[model samples]
Target: MSEIIRRDPRAEWIARNRLHPLHAALQSQNQTVWIGPNGIVRKNPHAIAAGFIGPAGIKRIDRSGAQQGTGTRRSASVEVQLPLHVVEQPAYYVAVVPDMVGGRLSSHDKDLLGLARRLAGSEGAVLAVVFGEHKESAFDSAGVDRLLLLDGEQYQGYAPEQRVLALRAVDNQFAPRHWLLPDSRTGGGELGRRLAASLGERPATRVWQAEGERCVGRAGAGQQDIQRPLARLILAAAECAEPVSETRHEARPVELAWQVARNLPRIEDLGPVAVDPAQIPMAEAEFILSGGNGVKDWELFHRAASALGATEGASRVAVDDGHMPRSRQVGATGTWVTARVYLAVGISGAIQHLQGIGACDKVVAVNLDPGCDMIKRADLSVIGDSSAILQALIERVAAWRQEGRRDAA
Candidate 1:
C-alpha cells in the first residue's frame, strides 16, 4: 500500500491572501484611492484612512506614507446621486412592512432587518416602510437607518389594495432598488408579486442569500435555486433566523401624504373572526402532529395530537381524502409550517410535503415502512404502525400522570 500525503490547509489560505486585490492596491504607492462617486482623492491621507476604517480609526501617515499614530476619526464624505427625470436615485435599502398579526413582529421581520443591514454595509442606509402599528424603538434597536411610518386607520387591516397604495406612495418618494418583504401566509408574497407586476420589475421569492447585487433562492415547485441581479427593482421574500442583538440607531419618521391616503379605494372592514386555539392554522403552529395517507382513522390522529398538545396537520392525501381540512394540509400546495417540533405520522414524505416542513426545527416520524422518505428525513424514526404507536404513547403519558398523582398522595 502506498502512503498518502496530505496538503496543508494554510497553503490554500496563503495563496488566497496573496491573490487579494487589496494587498496589491496597498503595495502600490502611486495608486490613488477614490473616496466616492466623483472618484476624487483627498489630499489629507487621514481622510483616505477614514474611508476604509469607517470614520472611527484615523491613522496619521508620515511623509514617507507610513503610519505614525492613531487620532480621532471623522465621518467620511460620500456624495449621493440625485434622482433625475424618468430615472430615480437608487435606494440604499428598503424593507416593506406587513401587517404583523397579533401586534407582534415575527422571525420574518427580524430577518428582513438582518438582510437590510448586510446589504446596506457601511455606504447605504437601511429604510423600513411601516403600514400598521410598529414600535419605533423596536426598529431603532434593530438598526433601521430610516423608518417611513404610514400609521392611521386607512393603513390598518389585511387589505392588499391599501398595502399596494401605501407601497406605491413610498416608491414614488424613494424609488428603492431593492425591496425586502416577509415570506408568510399573510399576504406579503402576494403583495410583493402584485407590486412587482404593477411596477414592471422582476421579483425574487423566498430568498435565503444575497451577495452584492445577486440574490439566490428557490424559484418554483421544483425548488430550483436561481440567482438574479439587484440592479433593477428587486423584491425578495425574507426567510430569516432568530434575531441577534445589533447596534441601535435613532429612527427618523417619514410622513405619508394625505392625498395618497385619500385616493385609495374604499373597502369595508369586517371584524375579526372567532377561532378555536385547538383549530389553529398549521402554518403558525409551534408543535404539529401531522397525518398522511397511511393514517386510516382520523379520530385516532386527532386524539394523538390532543394527547401530545400539538396542532393537527395533514399531508395532501389525507386532506384530499377528507380526513382533515384543507387549512391543515402541509405541502407545496398547502400551508408551510415553521414548527418547533413536527411529528409526522404515516407519511411517506413526498418532496412537496418536505418543502412545507423546511423550517421545522425537528421532525419525528412514525411509519410501518422503515425505508420511507419521512423516516429518512426524521430526526427520530419509529418503525411501527402510526395508530398503534400513538395509542401506546397516549397510554404511557396517562400512566405517567397517574403515577405522579399516586406519588403525590
Candidate 2:
C-alpha cells in the first residue's frame, strides 16, 4: 500500500498570512511556541504537559505516536465568519461606480469602495451602482452598504451615453453626496467624465488619496500631485485606499424610482473585434501569461497563452534574449501592467518586475525554485518545471473548452 500525504494550500496560505482572520486560530492550533504581539515569546503549558518521563532521566514527547500505536490526525480548520456591519437608515449616500471588468470587481474597484466606505463613515451609506450582469457575490465583504444593479441589454456592451443617462436618473432619485468611480481606461474613467459633464460637476480626476474635505491626485504625466478640496464627483486611481478586509457591510438592495431615458448613441459598438493576444497592450490586458529566462519552451508557452486566451508578456531577461519582442516586456523599464491575474512562468522576480506587477490583483507563479522572490510575492505558487506546468495547463484548458462545447451541444 502507498502512503498518501495531502497538502492544504488554504491552511498554508492562512498560516503564512498573519493579517488573515483565521491566522491566529490556525497558528494557535498548530504550534506550542510563538511570538506575542508585544515581541515576547509565549509558550503553551498544555503542549508542554503532553510530555512524559522516559526510561532515562530525560522527558520525551511522542510526536509520531509510535508507543500509542496510532498517529493523531490534525483537526479540520473551522471557517471564521466576519461580523456584519449594518446601516438601517443612512443620512447620505456616497455612490461608487466600479469598473466591473470580466463581470467581477477588480482591485481598483475594491480600492474605490474602501474610499467610499471611509467617506460614508457610519452616517452615510456606500452605494455600489453596478451596470450589466456581474459575477461578483462578495459585495458585503467589499464594503458595500447598498447595491443598485442596472441590468438590461441596453446597459450591456460599450454604451457610455446610455450609462450616463442611468447615472443621471440615479442622481435625481438618490441625490448621493459624492460620486466615486475608478479612474482607469476600462470604461470607468470615460463614464465618470460623461457623468460629471451631465451633472455639471467638476470632477477630481486621477485621485489617489481622499480624506475629509481634501483630495490628492496626480497632475499631467504623473510627475506632480494636485491637492484640492474634495469635489462632488471623484475619479480615483488604483490603490486610492486599502480594500475592506476587517469588517463586512449590510449590502442592502436599492432600486431606481423611475426608468432611465435612452438616446441614440453616436458611437456604435459593432460588437467586439478579434485581436491577437500579442497585440493587446499589457496594461489593458485583464489576464497575462508571462514568461522568464527559465522558460525553455517558447512555442509551448505561446500555445498555452493562446489556449488560455491570455495576453503574452516576458521578463526583461526573456526580452533581452530575443525570445520575445521589446513591447511584450513587462517591468518598470518596460510596460507596467495592471492585469487582474498575472501568471508568471519561471520568473525569478526582479525588483523592477515586481514593481511593474504591483498593481496586479492576483499573481500566480510557476517555478522550479521554491525560494525565488516571485514565489514569495505570488498569491499562489507551484514549484515545478515550467515546461511541464505549461503543458498541463494547456491540456486542462483544452479539456475545459471541450466540456463546455459538449454541454452546449
Candidate 3:
C-alpha cells in the first residue's frame, strides 16, 4: 500500500529457515540492524568486535604486587554497541525458503547473480534466501543484506491473513523497496501478503520483471494497489511462476476465489462482500474439559464432552479406537492448545503428548492409577476409574448449568 516495489525475480534472496544464509552473507559485507523510527541502517559494532569476559579476581600475592579488580575492557577494545548501516543504502531482495518435505539443495552464485540482477534491477539490490531454519549464514554472514524471520507465536500455518501479518513485520523492520519470496507452497506467501497490507496495498499475484523501482505485474487485484500493473507492484511470490498459472510462459497472476484470498480487493460487479462468520471456539469459558485415550469409552467421552460444553480431543490411544476425529487429536503429533482450564480423563501422560498440549492455565487429571504421569502433572489429581469420574462430573455439571440458568433468569 505504501509504495509497491515489484519482485526482481532474478535478484531475490532466500532465507532458509532458522538460519538465513543469504542474510548472513549480506551481513558479512554490510552489517546493520534496522531501527524502525530512524528509517536508517545504523552500524552494529558488537557483531564485528570480539567477545568479552567480566572482571577477574584480585591475586593476593607479593607485597609489591597489589592486584585488585580487573577491568574487562582491553586497551584496543571497541565500544559495546554494534555498528549500524544506513537504511536503503544497498537494496536487498528476498527468496522465500520455507521448510520443505525433502532433501537439501542450493543454487550457484551465477544463478543467484542472475536472479539478483533480474529482480533487483537496481545496482545495489542483491539476492538473499528466506526460510524458517537451517540458514546460519543469512543471519551471521554477509551475502544477504536483510534476514526476514516469518515465524512468530501467533503463527500456526500460512493459511489465510496470517501470511500478511508475517510480511508486514519484516517490511516494518526494514523498508525494502524490493522483497522477493519463492513461488513454493512452503515459501513465505503469508509474510508477503502481510507486508502488502501494511503499505495499505494488496499484492500482485504474478510478476515478471522490475524495471528500476517500478514492478511490472500481471493485471488483477494489483491494479487497485498500484498506479499501473506495469508500474510498482506487491506480491506473495509462491513459485518460480504463479500457482494459478498452468503454463510458465503464459503465466498470469494467481487469482484466488474471494473466499480463499481474504486479502483480495473488492470491486463492483464482483458481487457484494460477505463477512465471514466468527469462529466460535465451542464455549465462552476459557476452561476446557478434554477427552483423551484414557476416557476408555467413546459414548462416555462424547456424552461428558457435550455436558461440559467442551470439544473432544484425543491422545494416541483414543484415536485408534475411533473415539475422536483426526482434527480433535492432541499430542506431539497432534494439536497444540493453551486453554485456561484443562481436564484430562483417563490419560496417562506421555512426554510426547504432554509436549503437545501442556501449555494450559490449569490442568486437572482424574485417573485410576495414582502413579500415572498425568496425575503428577495435573494441578488437581482425582484418582478413580475414568467412567466413574465422568459419571460424577456430569451430575455436577448438570446442576451447575441449571443454577446458572436460574441465576440468569
* Candidate number with greatest TM-score: 2
Cα lDDT tens digits, model 1, 1-409, are 7545455556535433533323333343332354433455535354443233321123334355332245433223443222211102224555555435444455567677777667766656667776767533466556566777666777666577777877887888776656777656776777777777877877776777778767777667636888776534444455543242435554566675545666455667686685554767676787899999888877877787777778888899998888887888898899999886899999998989989997776799999987677877799999987778889988988898899999999
lDDT of 1: 0.67
Off by over 4 Å in 2: 1-79, 316-322, 325-336, 348-358, 368-385, 392-409
Ranking of predictions according to lDDT: 2, 1, 3
- Of the two candidates 1 and 3, the one with more favorable TM-score, higher being better, is 1
Which tens-of-lDDT digit does each residue in 253-296 have in candidate 2? 98998888877888888999888877788988989999999999
- Which residue window of length 10 is worst by lDDT in model 1? 80-89
> What TM-scores do the predictions have?
0.47, 0.73, 0.33
- Residue 40 of model 3, lDDT score: 57
> How many angstroms is residue 370 displaced in model 3 relative to the true structure, after the best TM-score fit?
1.2
Runs of candidate 3 exceeding 4 Å displacement: 1-287
Q: Which stretches of candidate 1 lie over 4 Å from their true place?
A: 1-93, 135-137, 231-244, 263-267, 281-283, 286-409
Candidate topping lDDT:
2
lDDT of each: 0.67, 0.87, 0.47
